[model samples]
Target: MTLPADITERLARLALPSQAVIDGAHVDALSGETFDNVSPRDGQLLNKVAACQKEDVALAVFAARTAFEDGRWRDQGPRAKKAVLFRLAELMERDADELALLESLDVGKPISDARNVDIPLAINTCRWYAEALDKVYGEVGASPVDRLSYAVHEPLGVIGAIVPWNFPLHMAMWKVAPALAMGNSVVLKPAEESPLTALKLGALALEAGLPAGVLNVVPGFGAVTGEALALSMDVDMIAFTGSGPVGRKLMEYSARSNLKRISLELGGKSPQIVFADCPDLEAAAQAAAWGVFYNQGEVCTAASRLLVEASIKEAFVERVAEVAKGMKVGDPLDPSTQFGAMVSERQMNTALGYIAIAGSQGARRVLGGGQVLKETGGFYVEPTIFDRLQPSHALAREEVFGPVLGVMSFTTEDEAIALANDTVYGLAAGLWTSDVNRALRGARRLKAGLVWVNGWDACDITMPFGGFKQSGFGRDRSLHALHKYADLKSVSVTLR
Candidate 1:
């Protein structure tokens, strides 16, 4: 896993955000423990990051609780919170390059994608909540003129946000922005695989004039640090984005602790259906190719299943195969690289194992079915695709969470919807059709939280993002997110 001379030099000069941020300062783990953060680019050691555990979580929760109870943040007027958040957004924009670099190095995403997509989106999220903080309005209950009854939204106090590694900073902001904008303190427990930006974000929060203990970051394994946060009684709410098992565990922990509110955004085995009368076959083919393959297919709402009409299935598959083949998979640091390595060797192995399982189950792999760039000792997987995959097959049913897509053919629209809804996931789905009636029908009939017609992943931060059914409850973005972070209380007053 060797890097080029320039990249090596740049990495050496780059300051890794390795320490945990607690009470507005960077500190080593109380246990003095550290873990090796290896680069997926070349399997090389990037740095030894603080392995914050239960003790760290306690400290962070205490900080968050103190800030909440003391009214250091929760009592701040909306304008104060807005100013702090706006400054934080400015800081993020200022450090965009370094943030993008840390994201790429830590998450194995391309630098360009980090800079163009994740970083900008995170900044926008911060600004969006900041700009909208003062605009949030409460309700007025209908009552007699002699009496007044009104409901006001109040902060939920200490919030524990546990975000995943795939898009660490971006996902963290999705929870952090609104939580903070609602005048609540936050304890951020970032995924172990990519903790750099979260740690940096905590520091940036302090720099943005957020009161001490308003934002704290602890980085460690899920079993240790994450468990502590979930089980903490001081936490008022747990906003989590990860796997289903973890989400269930969070719920159990919530009940076992203070019955604190828990919100989860989990996995999806989203299907992209294309009718024979698709308005643009080429456009649909491109969407099918990038929807699952982008971000190494680590997205929870990735269109992992392609359900197409039998008449154009072969042609559509060929176009997708061409796009996958042409995509360059190499170093994440390279701006030109379209695809990058897996976040870890373990993830690469999981994807490969899934590919093998699909083959054994009789699914035909139309494109890449194995690993590439093995000589570099890096974790890399070629964009893989399977054809004519049966709906009951494991590839089509399970969430691979990788760059592997299973294409299934359908004769009718009803069959396509059935094939799409057969899975346990109901996160997101997409359909491409030229018929306006069919488009409306499919968009309504699809069993998903978000459905895109004639496109894939076409929505943005302006829309609510989450899943239905087993994909977990609660949402991450849009104005709905603000309501999730606050509690409504009705006050009645009588005037003489």
Candidate 2:
């Protein structure tokens, strides 16, 4: 795919920095190691960033610990923290275009999505958390006649956040915003594949008047920097968003360490059920395609398993296939491109491998199962669908984490619920029905942590987001996020 003229101009104008931020300053890896930032589009080199390891991770954790203990940030009033965060959000908005370009170039996401969805959501999250800082308060409890009692939340010192590459900026902010808003210092480890935006955020936070060492970015591979953060005894909490295996490893690290608080938001093979009672089959089909195909189906809450009523199975699948076919794939920088390259060659291969597995399993391919744009040297896969799916089939049970959908038919609500809840994953589920009773009942019965009725993957800062089973525990957004970053202390005093 040829780079558009405007994209070329932006690429020429933007200069991506390669160092990690520690104590509000850019620095090289202690071992002087670096890793290439390969653009999945056309397989070009974006830049080489510091490959932070145990030494750098130790430095960052120590900095955060010092900052927290100094009382510069942890003792700051809510209004002061709010002011700095608001400034940080403003700085992000000011550099929105540059951040978006870097995100698209580094993560293989379309520039439009980076600009319109990822960057804006990240900024709004910061602002939202900033506003929330002053609104929450401690509480006083009814006590014995001779005593007084109250409860207050206190910051948990230093926090470690390991974020994924799919939505690098937004995911980082999901951890950073609330943790900082609650007056905790943080060390963030961005995924190796996409570290540019997180580094940029660290710089912006410093420029926004965040105190030194309060927000540090360690850019490197997960095995090194991530593991170090997970195992760091100085860090009080570990908040991670990634695969289940890694999440489990972090939990183990916590157990082996100081038993610090651990919050994990992991994988999902979420189900979207379409009933004949849905008001509009066409809309449902369109939504289903968008739910699975958005972000190239890299979303944790993507509706990848489509369970349709037997009456509408054929029609819904056909319509969804058409919708998937209509989505364009090309250069991520192009404004018209709907789906861009996969994050890397390895990821594309993973998606293709899943397609091959489906074929071998005798699942019928409905549309798209092969590589697209083979001439471009980009990691691109066609939006794919597989039918003849049993609840136990690999395609239905496992998270393909690409634009692959598994289709099945159910005759009754009980069967639909059973098939939807069959997988160990319970991150999210979607159902479309005009019957309010069925919607309510299905939502209550779904094993997933989040249920969407007549909608899919719509999130608000107000809602708690997490999973029920192997998908991992603990929520990421809303007021619930504060719980992960602080300790609630109960106080009682005896009357003289």
Instruction: Choose the strongest candidate by TM-score.
Output: 2
Candidate 2 overall Cα lDDT vs. reference?
A: 0.92
| TM-score for candidate 1, residues paired by index | 0.98
Q: Give Cα distance to truth, residue 337, candidate 2, Å.
A: 0.2
How does each model score on TM-score? 0.98, 0.99
lDDT, candidate 2, 253-338, per-residue tens = 99999998899999999999999999878889998999999999889998999999999899789999999999998888898899
Per-residue C-alpha lDDT of model 1 across residues 209-259, encoded as one tens digit per residue: 999998999999999999999999899999999999999999999999999
**Would you list the clashing residue pairs of candidate 2?**
none
User: Where does candidate 1 stray beyond 4 Å?
Assistant: 1-9
Whole-model Cα lDDT of every candidate shown, in order: 0.92, 0.92
What lDDT is reached at residue 64 by model 2? 94
Candidate 2 residue runs with Cα over 4 Å from true position: none
Backbone clashes in model 1, listed as residue pairs: 1-42
